[model samples]
Target chain A: SQQGEEDPQALSIQEGENATMNCSYKTSINNLQWYRQNSGRGLVHLILIRSNEREKHSGRLRVTLDTSKKSSSLLITASRAADTASYFCATDASRLWDDMRFGAGTRLTVKP
Target chain B: DTEVTQTPKHLVMGMTNKKSLKCEQHMGHRAMYWYKQKAKKPPELMFVYSYEKLSINESVPSRFSPECPNSSLLNLHLHALQPEDSALYLCASSLPGQGPSGNTIYFGEGSWLTVV
Candidate 1:
């Protein structure tokens, strides 16, 4: 079963625009991580935000975790054409340590 | 090396033909995983190996066999696969225990399998 679900199944924007994707999970999670995939290829680690922390930033990526609402969001600042890809959020909870479920993912396309 | 490598970037096999997907990682990660992904779907956990031991099975079909020869290698054996079984076979690795701080997974390019 999938623990996390990403909203806005697809998003398209210009090269300089910002891309924001949201994810919601069911259970109390220890941490949530985001990944990027090009086409049908494997995933690439983007950023990780823990339950204890409310928000985090890495380069142009900003991740915010809202445990109260059981949701998280990934913000890509100044998106580029190369940033166009499928973004997925994975949730790792307490009970299921080894079982990390991924969301359906959000497809973001940055038009150049 | 810090990356995971998989062999046979693409594979085509018949319904009755048997083939195996190989994955290797030199990051010394204690845990390895096999995930099956269909088009427009998220990767599904098939099997997990921790410290050379099969930890989680996810109730995957018996036709899909997983092997961990050593700490640095993981293999998925496929046999009698159906047409719907054709999908991307991805290999990922992470640190054994938990916590996103120390346990971040790295994935390979994946093996695209087409069953005909």
Candidate 2:
């Protein structure tokens, strides 16, 4: 079974608008990571937030995690048309190696 | 460097044909993974290799065999595949540990497989 589930399957906005995506998980996680995937391409690591940390920022990206709610949100500020891609949240619930499970993903379209 | 490279970016094979997908990483990551993704879907975990040994197998079919030749190379051998098996095969690698850095997986460009 998939560990994470994302909401608002699709979103559309202007180039300068901010885009937000939410993800809910079923189990406890040591870390939650966000990845971006272009069409017909592989995933690219975006940001990772530890369970002990509530929020993290990188460049124009902001990620928030709520362990109690078992959810996480990824916010992309000042989005660009190049930022249009599918964003997925992956949860690492295992204590051993990388046992990351990903969500269905939210497709974001930034119109120029 | 920090890239996980995969060969044969696109492939087409018949149900009876045999093929192999190769992945390599030069970052010295000990953990490697294989994932299958369908259109508009999340990538599914297929296999995981740690320290050149198979650590996790998600009950993948026998026709899909994964091999870790060393710490830097991983390969997936395919045989007698069904059309439904056609999808994007992704190769990823990361450090082996419990820390946040260890969980950050670097992915290759992926191989688009079409089983006819």
Candidate 3:
């Protein structure tokens, strides 16, 4: 079963704009990770934010986690057409075996 | 290397054919996983191997068997699969003994499968 649901199932924006995707999960988690997948390819790990961390940034990617709300948001600043892909959020829920559950994903298209 | 290598990037098999998908990781990760993904959908966990042991099976069918011979090699043996089972099969691995929340998981480029 899927654990997380990403809002804005699909988004399209002009280049240089900022794209934000939100995710909400049902259970408590140890950490939240965001990944990007190009068409027909493997997932690329973007950034990880632990439960205790409220925000993190990597390059143009900024991730904010709200443990109290069991939600997280990923922001891609200065988006480019190369950023076109599906973004997914995964949560561990502190499982011993590392069974990460992924969200439905947000399809972001940066129009150049 | 840090990559997960998956073999037969594309596969087309008959319903009665028996085929195997192989994955290898040299990053010394102890946990390996198999996930099935339909187009535009999130990948679903099918199996997990921790320390070369079968740790989690998400009630996958009997026809889909997973083998982890060692810490570096993982294989998914397929037999008598239906057309509906055709999808992108992904293999991923993470650091030794780390929970999903503990480390980043590296994914293969997914084997595209089609069952006729």
Q: Which candidate ranks first by DockQ, i.e. highest?
A: 2
Deviation in Å, model 3, residue A49 alpha carbon: 0.6
Estimate, for each residue in A1-112, the C-alpha lDDT of model 2 and write its tens digit. 4889998899999999999999999988888999999999989999988888999999999999999999999999999999999999999865754788999999999999
DockQ of each: 0.62, 0.70, 0.66
Candidate 1 structure quality by residue, lDDT tens digits, A34-94: 9999997889999888889999999999999999999999999999999999999998766
Q: Which runs in model 1 stand beyond 4 Å of their true positions?
A: B100-102
Model 3, B5-73: lDDT tens digits are 999999999999999999999998999999999999999989999899898899999999999999999
Candidate 3: regions farther than 4 A off: B99-101
Number of backbone collisions per candidate: 0, 0, 1
For candidate 2, write residues B3-60 as lDDT tens digits: 9999999999999999999999999899999999999999999999988988889999
lDDT of 3 by residue, A1-112 (tens): 8999999999999999999999999998878899999999999899988888999999999999998888999999999999999999998857553788899999999999
Give residue B113's lDDT in candidate 1 (0 to 100): 96
Estimate TM-scores for all models. Answer: 0.97, 0.97, 0.98
Docking class of 3: medium
Which residue pairs clash in candidate 1? none
Q: After superposition, how far is residue A111 of candidate 3 from its true place, in Å?
A: 0.3
- The CA lDDT of each predicted structure is 0.90, 0.93, 0.93
